[model samples]
Target: MAGILSLVWFVGSVLITPFLMILLCIVFLASIGKSLGVRRLYVKLLLIIFEFGRANIETAQKGSNAEDTSEEDEEHIEEISPLNSNATNDIKHLKTPNGLKKPNNGYVPNGNSVISRDDKLILVPEPPFTMHKTDETTDLSEAKDKCKDYDLCNIFDYLKAGMESIIEDQVTSRFEAEELKNWNLLIRTNRRYEFISWKLTVMWVCGFFVRYFFLFPLRVTICFFGVWWLTLCTALVGYVKEGDFKQKLNKYVSVMCFGILSNAISSVITYHNEENKPKSGICVANHTSPIDVLILMCDNCYSLIGQSHGGFLGILQRALARASPHIWFERSEVRDRHAVANKLKEHVSNPKNPPILIFPEGTCINNTSVMQFKKGSFEVGSVIYPVAIKYDPRFGDAFWNSSKYSMMQYLYMMMTSWAIVCDVWYLPPMQQNEGESAIDFANRVKSVIAKQGGLVDLVWDGQLKRTKPKKEWRERQQEEFSKRLKVE
Candidate 1:
């Protein structure tokens, strides 16, 4: 194939007049002249060298005729080899100039042996010139003394780093837009991405002010009133009818009322399989935010079970604890998981009990996926009812990344949005299959919920998603330092 391609290329080049001129000139000279173009000069040079060599040989022969035969024979006898192959091999390697010696090749290098003791030991030829070198060793003590005299710090280096960081972050910022999209409903409808998209910088700035100054006051007022109204009615329910049939009615009613108030802010709420909503039994739901409670309880009230969150939400949970059957398990009791399970079992002792709502993902996810479920809720021998909740972030992101904002901060951002839209799916009751362990049962329930709600099923245990803000701070500074170096 190579020969064929070469032949075709040669023919193509010969077809051109300039290529033919160069090619034919060389061929014609080589065929008819005494020598080819370069060969003609080489022949003249060789003849001159031959003449010089012959004259030198004649002069050497005339000079050597006076030399004694006896001295020549004695010198030859001393220099001759004695059938030693080892000495012959050394001679072979030594004859080849610039041959490097291996450390353990079982041969004396450069004939550094008795046979070549008188011979020069020129292993490698001396270099033409010595390289000019500057001293590079750093003296810490001297440097410290110098620094003390003039306060010589790395401020210049720091300035260079910061400048590089600013430039690098600016240059690459355009490409780091929300490249992964449409993976789930969350990503498909994320409007908050305006803050990140390079093309939407101006629009985002405008939206920010419009969101805060124009729409902030009205939403906060509504949220403020809803909080108090929900609190009072909840207190009234608990006080009027505690542990009776009327209490159940009041609890469900209060939840529905809270849901209605929340729905007023969002302007959109819908649910499926409202009939399968349980009055009492273990109820597990996918959690995305604190608002998940209101969404799930829109139709049926369920007692929440989890550790209490801090801040405004924590206070709200505490207030609700006095009114509803929401149980905040003590997280410090690490040695008493079995005791905790027993307590959980006791909570659902009654069939008429308000169905205990368990957000198995202990922490909220970004609605990209349903995170792993804690098996404690499924461990109880009750029929586990599964619910899937999904939100449309086209109007607002309901997933609260609390690290960047407080509860009030997040809620204000949410309420002032165009609207919060969501869907609830109350999947069919999932019972533990024969001999299925609690983890297996929980996973089964989680998979069904993820499938039903168009959510991704992630394998991470949500409990392990605790924010390491302190560690990440150090890492962030290091990352910034590295970015600066990269740009430089």
Candidate 2:
């Protein structure tokens, strides 16, 4: 019986202890929650008090604007504080950052600075210290009488006393500052987290599609959809990423259509040697917009060599590796210049992908003027085809907004615009000679385009300029030649 009782007691203690511990934990969490709630309430109350006090002070100042100075004097006395003359000299000697003298005179010294009988310097501790205007206007007897009553100076004293009170109130309300700091930090953290989440989601979704669906049949189908689908996809992505699709689309469509139209027009309008046909060469053009890619891709046989921005985009490029033959470049791959050059060389060498499209301008520029071309594309063994595209007068104003206009608004502007026009001039292809440098070749091509396309001023040679031949000289020369022939 004793053993059973002991065992029962032990069991009861073990079970009850855990329940009590859990209850204690519950109480601790509840207490913490209550404390935070009280702190939040306190901060809100303090803000309300500060706002109310500030408003009341402003209202009081306004109300006293019409009050008579004499009555104010009757209410309070003015205390005259002596200024130290030496302190004033010290302040005047102070220098500014630019080695200039201090603007305001320094504090008074020796407490010997005399106060005028009418003009009393009263120090009011409130913001924008107050000054009472007094002169011959106040009766001497009345001024002396008012100066004796300290209560007459109560207005200035009240202003001083209220200032200290306001400062103390502000100190008590510091919880508001803490709350605002915490709120801002929370918002910033949330925004960062949201962006990270969005990037992760995009990666996952894009990866899943490329890995599973973007295989043989699907890839072929995507290719067949042609420029329109590519444009739509690119526009959709730009819209999602930037929240502006219309302007980007417009710029894209305009540049692309211009290229196509220019090519078609040139085919009919331009004359060329049919027998000594221009060999297939890499077309190097200025890259003003992403639509430039589609324009080049219009020739289905021509493959693209693009630098891939990693992750899902890179994976997508890899999946279409055979079809597109893109040069997959990591963002960090810029550190390895040789690797990039080698990749470019390999892609350009492929016989199947002749005439690689290269944007030698390096970056997008306004369509008005062409930037200097980068020389990397010229180094490729293939002949270089220089093409100059000029937009029609109407679409020349289409520049990407770096200021007030957002992407979406820009897109809308483009969609509303009518037809876009452009001129495409294809210069003759250039072959690399044994001793010719890339820079020399580039300059030579640039000169040809500038001359033939009216890009530079034309000058005529003196020998080519002819004046009308003298009729008498011509007749005399003919008669002499006939006499010489008779003698022979």
Of candidate 2, the 10-residue stretch with the lowest lDDT total is: 176-185
Residue-wise lDDT of candidate 1 within 194-260, one digit each (tens)?
A: 3333333454466557556644654554456566766676666667655676666566555545653
Per-residue alpha-carbon lDDT of model 2 for 1-488, expressed as tens digits?
A: 99999999999798567645643443343323222243235335434533443344334434554365434433322222233343343333221011122221221111112222112112222211122335547555444444443343435544554443343221112111111111111121222311223443454355335323422222222233322333444445443433235434333433333333222111112222223222345767654454444344432223345677454334434433433345556568845767766776786675544355676655444353343455676776677777665433222123333233454454333333222234456666777788998876766665554554433211111111123435774575456334322311
Model 2 vs. true fold: TM: 0.35
Give the C-alpha miss distance for residue 408 in model 1, angstroms. Answer: 2.5
Which stretches in model 1 have alpha-carbon errors above 4 Å?
1-210, 243-245, 309-311, 467-488
Backbone clashes counted, model 1: 0
- The lDDT, on a scale of 0 to 1, for candidate 1 is 0.57
Q: TM-score of each candidate?
A: 0.53, 0.35
Whose lDDT is greatest here? 1
